[model samples]
Target: MTVVQITLRKKRLGRSLAGDIVLFGLLALVGCFMALPLVFVISNAFKPINEILKFPPDFFVRNPTFTNFYDLYHLLAGSWVPLTRYIYNTFFIAFVGTAGHVIIASMAAYPLAKRKFPGKTFLFTVVVLSLMFSATVTQITNYMTMSWLGFLDTHWAVIIPAIGSSLGLYLMKQYMEQIPDALLEAAEVDGCSEFRIFWSIVMPVVKPAWLTLIIFSFQGLWGAGGAAGSMYIYSEQLKTIDYAFSQILSGGIIRTGPSMAATLLMLSVPILIFIISQSSVIQTMSTSGMKD
Candidate 1:
């Protein structure tokens, strides 16, 4: 190649190299952003109580110990956690709440998306209006309703109001809208009942949406109101992990190192679940359409 041609090629190569470096750097920055909290938690979990408040955080745990985990589980000589109980309560609440949300929300959404009925416009309008206010804004009323229903201080108390939420129904309706009408028709033509059509045909196509709801429900309940109000099994045995954590914190025993460790451990499961759930939540949301 001529000198000018060689110079031009060199210039292109330099640009390409610079572009790659910039792209990689941006990705690394994002990765660090995501990992920083997790890294801090992991390090703190291993440290002793004193190191957590050191002038500068002890970035490394000089002597790593699994004591935090044991203590949280009530497994050590001076144990505090009711580990198995918390695990059971959390999973039970999370699973039931999630499953119910998926079922009831999708059931509500299916009709909103596809079928027309009496007072349809009015009902939808009301739902839309309610969306303007969130759970926090309505907490007092919700708490009162739970009290009236004799569900207060019980697992059902938490579960009922959660299943009443519009968010999941809204999301499901958006997803159900993306399902072609012809598919429902085909299911009907094949001698399927409405229930079968919904169970076998409609539901299969909305797996991504279902997955999204599951993750959302799990994460939401694990941290917030999901496990907060259950009344059954009054003790460590009945309380959810979130509730247990709250109890610990409330007792004014915030072991910085162990608290950080326990918190990080508690946070890890949902993070992993979210990573697994992102694809579906994104896909279903991206494909869903809004109604007029």
Candidate 2:
């Protein structure tokens, strides 16, 4: 190669490196900006009541204390309903709802994605259209349906509705479309039943998609607190941990520290779940092969 060509190639490489560095720096800045609220929550959880109520709030706690956590424990302990009961209700609903959502979504998505059938286009269109409507828009309809089905004032009211979430179904369908038809065909040629193929082959291959679905579904159900159940569940014993914490938050300004502590405790579960499965979530989002 001539020296001039070599020098030009070197310049291109330099420019590419500079562009990459600039992009990385910008992304880092944006990430930090997004993380500020999370950092502030963590900081406030450790702050003393005096610091929490200071005129100008400090970003970091100067006098860290565990008093908030202690207060939260005592307050909840004094409630008529046991703290363990609230915790049990929350976990039961979140886990059961998330599991049902993942299974139902995946099962529905598989056929819509890989098989040709009558009304497939129309059905998929309905799902896409459903995504445009917020849960609030369908609240009255859902309540009526639950009432008709005799599901009102029960855990099933929350679990059953969450199981049919359109978002999870849509995401699974899109991700499943990326799986090659050849794989399913091969399984069928070997005399594998549709259910067998779905459970064994398709499910294992689409692990990332469902993992992402779990994160989304669980986060929604977890953060929903009593709102999802409030309309259906009137029994105090059936109330979730979030509902209980919300009571603490409503206890005037004096409960600010404990409220912050409760907020952190509530957020910790979802954040931890996301951290554990974040790689799968990223993989599912990044590797889609769907074509318009």
On residues 1-292, what C-alpha lDDT tens digit does candidate 2 reach at each position? 9996899999887777778899999999999999999999999999999999998889988988999999999999999999999999999999999999999999999999999999999999999999999999999999999999998878889999899999999998988887888888889999999999999988877888899889989999997766964678888899899988986579899999999999999999999999999977677555644333
Candidate 1 weakest lDDT stretch, 10 residues: 225-234
| Candidate 1: tens digits of C-alpha lDDT, residues 1-292 | 8996899888887777678899999999999998887887788887766676677776778878877666655522233544675677677777788889889998888888888889877877777788899776887787788778887666766777778888888888877887788877877888999888888877877888889888888788777632353432344445676666655654444544456656886788888889888976677655653333
| Clashes by residue pair, model 1 | 72-81, 153-231, 154-231, 155-231
What is the Cα-based TM-score of model 1?
A: 0.78
RMSD of 1: 7.2
Off by over 4 Å in 2: 1-20, 282-292
Count clashing pairs, candidate 2: 1
Error of 2 at 206 (Å): 1.5
TM-score of each: 0.78, 0.90
Clashes of each: 4, 1
lDDT of each candidate versus the true structure:
0.73, 0.90
lDDT, candidate 1, at 128? 79
